[model samples]
Target: MSTVNDTKFSFAVFFLTGIPGQKDVHVWISIPFCLMYLISIVGNSVIVFIIKTDPSLHEPMYIFLSILAVTNLSLSISTIPIILGIYLFNSREISLDTCLAQLFSIHFLQCTESSVLLLMAFDRFIVIHDPLRYASVVTLPRIAKMGLVCVLRAVAVVVPLLFLLKRFQYGRANVLSHSCCLHQDVMKMVCSDITVNNIYGLFVKILTMGLDSLLIFLSYVMILKTVMSITSHTESIKAQNTCVSHLFAVIVFYTPEISLSVLHRFGKGSFPLIQILLGYITLLVSPVLNPIVYSMKSKHLHANIIKAFFK
Candidate 1:
């Protein structure tokens, strides 16, 4: 039972492996990763810019979406330096402090994104169940407050990881499986008892991702119930259609995340490169696709996007 107070490895350094076993193709692999990162930054930036300029998009749904875009941008930005370092420069050595900082930022952004999605779900619920009060209930101040809470909660939950990780003494090879530093990946290198790290990691996952997912599910269930009660089939379809983009966004965000989680926890037979691919997908897909999905699906946003580009 190694306690956190026993060891303090403040200055340890870890080497990052860029797609283990596929070292020969790292440069080739980096092509797509770089492309995706570029697209995500451009796409999400455009979304945020469009939302800020268009007063018409000053609604709760778009506001929450802007938060998601910002979170995706943060996630993409946080990983780029280290990932690109591994792929392009073969610079795999990262200081302990840098690794911990990256780990915290990555998870914090993930938690914030999850929280934003939950707020989006709540927005949909209000719009469906109480359309009359939608504007009043989801006001600008309230949305701003919700966004603040989301960010604050993410910070609060991830800050403890810094304390927990600092206590571990990394006596192993100190090599990470992924190009980017992840809490689970880093914890595996520690020589001391990792029971606290494991438990805390699980607790954070359940607290942030687990709880948000459950609420989002329940929201959609209620949304479906409301849609089903409509007298006209066309009306029901129309009501459900509003959620199509959000549903796609949710699927895009969670599928890769769940797959990555499964790979890390249970997919021992899976190749290391396969896990790394999933890691890339988890980081890249949502950020790249989210703004595109919203822009293609929302007529107002699409029009604004065109106007912004051509005007």
Candidate 2:
């Protein structure tokens, strides 16, 4: 019953939506969600643990992988609580401040993940393009610095979004389209003109993920060229094989993300259920798959995991 003019940011509460038209089966809907979170948490945790404890795995590549595992773990942790709360307890109401915090954390981690993938691509490129200098050029200290820059870049870009959303006046119709808060979902609920918000959101996406995607593509192109120039066919195949896991990681992370972003911007008339599903996939799939893909592809990691757990 509150008018747009009467609503204050401090007092505003947003309702989150879960599994459209399945309010009766919210508890049932949570089973798969819970499983995905469990896999993401335990899988990524083991990856990080192995990397941290093993001295032989302290190279730049494994260190980067550990950073990525930590990022995936953080991303899953940020959203799982509220999502499970909504499904199990029907606790869908989220305060404006909490919603904004969730939004920031999710997007920041996303940007950080994109950065990590870019770093991985660069790592692969160095390993393939210049194997001897790989250790010299991509040292652990440099990798640590790169990881710090990724976090800083994410912070710089995502923090401004909090301020941008704060200036908007929201109305009583505060139901979010997803079980967790997203910038686009929250921006849609604002009663004020969101042109600036939309523009800035797009700008951030372009500057971070968009740019990262382009760089990753360029890195791969160079990697392929380097591989082809190798006169030894077996060596070329071997070098190309090293990149397969990182390539799969890129596809798993970016495909749903790009689909969701395009759907939000251009698929206004598209089914709401499709958007909701893509939203969940964008948030959950990479976290669940990355650890599996890397473990299966990297013999060293696979052996370590088996030796640690099975032995």
Candidate 3:
């Protein structure tokens, strides 16, 4: 047993438990995780490559799509090493600094994805509501600036978490529930009072994920209103068709996350395996699904992918 003062500012390592009570079959579990990571990496990378090499895709919408792919890849890359290590190599011990870095990168990339989706919504809204000014309003330079601001905003919000968590003395068992480090999970191990950490974590969640989800919803509502007002039924259908991919992406991205967060926060007494499974789904599902969804929905992208592969 460790004491507070003894470990104060002296904590240096954390042991990651991949999934509680599933140790015997951790190897079997890695099979699906490895498959998902491979698919996500390849799928998102293909999207980025297609968008970059195709001259016709140099528009705001596809630009945002490329950014989404890049963000998904970042998210997957951020978490994969530790996940593979824990499951395959039995390397569960992560240095304090490494854990902190992983925690920051994972959360930062998640927040950036949310922001990019929000920007995608805005792009759709502009194109649909004011098609005449779409090109002028959402210029390449503006999109570049928007991506920069999204990353900077995530950094601004997540950097404080590092400082806040660092101030605490974690003298308890530093075993994490998931393969990857998360702000909330790591905070639970601190020996000192973590009231501020909890409160601020909730605040940051509401500020980033909560608020972004709300705005994305509102953007779609407005989009629906505009689409319905279109005189031609064919035009309305086309407009709605443009949103199918994004809508699917948003659903996969938020549903698992919201469910996992709720389960962690309030679903006490839930099965540990269920919680661990949900955590993996939340982290892995969207990246693997997003590019596939987009490719299936967007005829142009789909054709481009097929052409690129077959040619």
Quote each prediction's TM-score: 0.93, 0.96, 0.94
Clash number for candidate 1: 0
* lDDT (tens digit, per residue) of candidate 1 on 1-311: 35443333554779887766677888997898788889889999999999998999988888888889999999999997678888888999888888888998899998899998899888988898889999789888888788889889999989998899886677524878888888878887887898898788888888998899899999999998898788898978777877888888888877777777777767754677778778877777888899888999888899999998898
lDDT of 2: 0.91
lDDT of 3 by residue, 158-195 (tens): 99999997777664347877778988788878877888
Worst 10 residues of 1 by lDDT: 1-10
Show where candidate 1 strays beyond 4 Å.
1-11, 267-271
Each prediction's whole-model lDDT (CA) = 0.85, 0.91, 0.87
Model 1, C-alpha of 261: deviation from truth (Å): 2.6
Output the TM-score of candidate 1: 0.93
Point to the candidate with the largest TM-score: 2
Any idea how many clashes model 2 has?
Answer: 0
User: Who is ahead in lDDT, 2 or 3?
Assistant: 2
TM-score, model 2 to reference = 0.96
lDDT by residue (tens digit), candidate 2, 32-140: 9899999999999999999899899998889989999999999999998789999999999998889999999999999999999999999999999999998799987
The prediction achieving the highest lDDT against the true structure is 2
Report residue 22 deviation for candidate 1 (angstroms): 2.6
